[model samples]
Target chain A: MEPIVAYSLVLSAVLFTMGVLAVLARRNPIIMFMGIELMLNAANLAFIAFSRHLDKLDGQVIALIFMAVAAAEVAIGLAIIVSIYRYRRDVDVDAVNVLRG
Target chain B: MNVIELIVFIAAAALALVGAAGMVMSRNPVHSALFLIANFFALAVIFLLLSAPVLAALQVLVYAGAIMVLFLFIIFFFVQPGQKHLYVYSLPWQTFFSGILVIVLICILVLGLYMGGVFTAEEHVQSAAMKVEELTSPQALGSALFSRYLLPFELTSLLLLAAMLGAVVLARKEGRGDMEEKD
Candidate 1:
């Protein structure tokens, strides 16, 4: 509705596209995970914009919850990556595909 | 919509875009992590501009400070010589097609927003005129989190505990078990 909200939404979209690009093109699993984080940040940006527009605290609360989930996700994911790396010196996603059934 | 606010938004948006680009383009994973930190800081500024000061602070503290530090630590601890060049020098067919797909996705999303009349929609009518302070104060956020969102809040804590345990177990060496291997 407002110019600021519109601009922020557009920016969010752009950031999300970049994240998609990173995930698609990069070989490194960590970079792909970071791209996922970028996508989450874009969603949070949109949440904040809508929260301000509606004058509601619900969106901010949701964003906070999203942050907690993301942190937990990163922890478990990096652990998995670390363990995979220990068995097979390389950390490339393509090389780590021992589960291709 | 004042001049200063407009300028701040534009600058922050630019910073965020550059950071995103740098993160994607960097050859080294460490550089990408640093760029992501810059992007997170820019997003925090944008969050503040959106009147979410508490969320903005948390964004900086948790996302940029904590999560990225974890990323950097992993990169440093487990980096291999082969990973020095993370990005491919020449674009593969898949990468090229994916770039085209990204362009199409962005066009669709923006067009969908425009078609949904988001740009022309009127502001939501607030039951009471809210002061800027009341919008996203830490106290208000705390009340909402504790009252209406209590179950979800508690679930988040449980999730974090599980993740902590999972990380410890997953990262432990299999043969050595809990004890350190003697060199």
Candidate 2:
């Protein structure tokens, strides 16, 4: 068995789960953003792993593109957070529950 | 089964996991971002061990070199670090509950292995590192990207361009009334 590769894949899944838990469990906006980043990187790790296992560069290319998308996500997300902060002075997810429709 | 490769793999994995844990645990967004960068570096090192130097190079350049800098800049410049701390969860039980959830998730993962993935061991003749030539050569990657993956490649570039525009528009400094009104 290629234990290393398996372990990395499993770890990637574990981290993705952690990131999911972070998003679900935490109520802070910034913390949620961090969790989302964790999830993105977790998925990226899987991409790299599959790329290596297949002996192809496809996963690497996807991972690069994913990084770009993740960066843009943070940019837009942080901007939204800033705008929210400007009005309420807090990034608490619970407090901003007015749009709870 | 070589001692050196084993040591390297274990070390890279350990560093990555430690930094990952720290990023999740830290309250400071800046610290979390920094720890994530550390985790990214460890992952890139592991990619090197897997003989994907191009992937590893991109991991360092695109992840550590570029994206993280964007994160740090936003956190530092957009928000005042000293402004009163804005903690979200008020109850201590929230943390305790999440901890138990992590434990349960781990159990499920272990059970997943027992259920199937080992059922078949198709002989994989190609060594994990089939050829250093495939991984290291820009020519190989270029042809693959431009030939086999041309459509997806162009699509991804367009997607990135769209994302940049969306990010700028949403994060714009002025005329954020819609957001402010909701806040």
Candidate 3:
């Protein structure tokens, strides 16, 4: 049956939407970081789905790489957020302008 | 439909959705971190269903297990104001963009289901890439990872180690020998 794949696509869609909402709705720097992770995860799900659709393992490989990068991003991101908070005593990203272009 | 996979699929989807909701809704940074971990676990289940045993294992080991633990540790040590801090939301355009995106995704999913596509091993990569019984046994995936994809695997692990070191360096206040000492 195609149910599992269908289910997966739907799940991925839901996850993607959730990520969008998180990125849109969060004000805390850490929470925004989490939102970015969610978005990467949604892309990973799509990668797996397309890999299956194409009958190859390549998508899985790409997804694996993405996950690793996501970890690095989050680690570096939280560290930056922490340092910023330490200096300014707040993590409200909207108000910060130290590194903005 | 057999019971277990269906149950797992449903549970995983719910876990992911609720975890995402919690991450967005929680005022406390600690709670957001916790929910993000839960979301990772839910994703591991979805990966398992795709028949990529290696991905599933890594999903749990790397995302839920190691990385999230680091996030929580940082929050515990450094996010003191997380408790009493005020929360802010996204800009108006962001919400509008997200709303439009959700509507498009729903339409796509509905179309996919209505197409009533057939399944075959030779069919485009579709479900056959991970047809649990024949293709995606742990043995099969493990061998593939170690054999064909070995170099990438080694590099990924190396990247992970680098990320850990980076976190330690960034989190600690000192620059060199006094590294462990916090300000």
Top model by lDDT, which number?
1
Clashes per candidate, residues 3 or more apart or on different chains: 0, 0, 6
**Mind sharing the TM-score for model 2?**
0.83
Q: Per-model C-alpha lDDT, please?
A: 0.89, 0.73, 0.75
Write candidate 2's Cα lDDT for A1-101 as tens digits: 35555667777877777786777666767767777888888888877777766667888777766776776677678767776776666667766767521
Give a tens-digit lDDT track for model 1, residues B110-134. Answer: 9987987778957554543364668
For all predicted structures, in order, the TM-scores are: 0.92, 0.83, 0.77
Residues B93-138, model 2: lDDT tens digits: 7778887887787778757754646333556656644454677566
DockQ of the two-chain complex in candidate 1: 0.66
DockQ of each model against the real complex?
0.66, 0.47, 0.47
In candidate 2, what fraction of native interface contacts survive?
0.35
Stretches of candidate 2 off by over 4 Å are: A99-101, B85-92, B118-132, B175-183
Global local distance difference test of model 1? 0.89
Q: Which regions in candidate 1 have their CA more than 4 angstroms from the true location?
A: B81-92, B121-131, B176-183
User: Which lDDT tens digits does candidate 3 get at residues B60-81?
Assistant: 8988887778778777776775
Estimate the overall C-alpha local distance difference test score of candidate 3.
0.75
* Candidate with more favorable, higher lDDT: 2 or 3: 3
lDDT score of residue B123 within candidate 3: 32
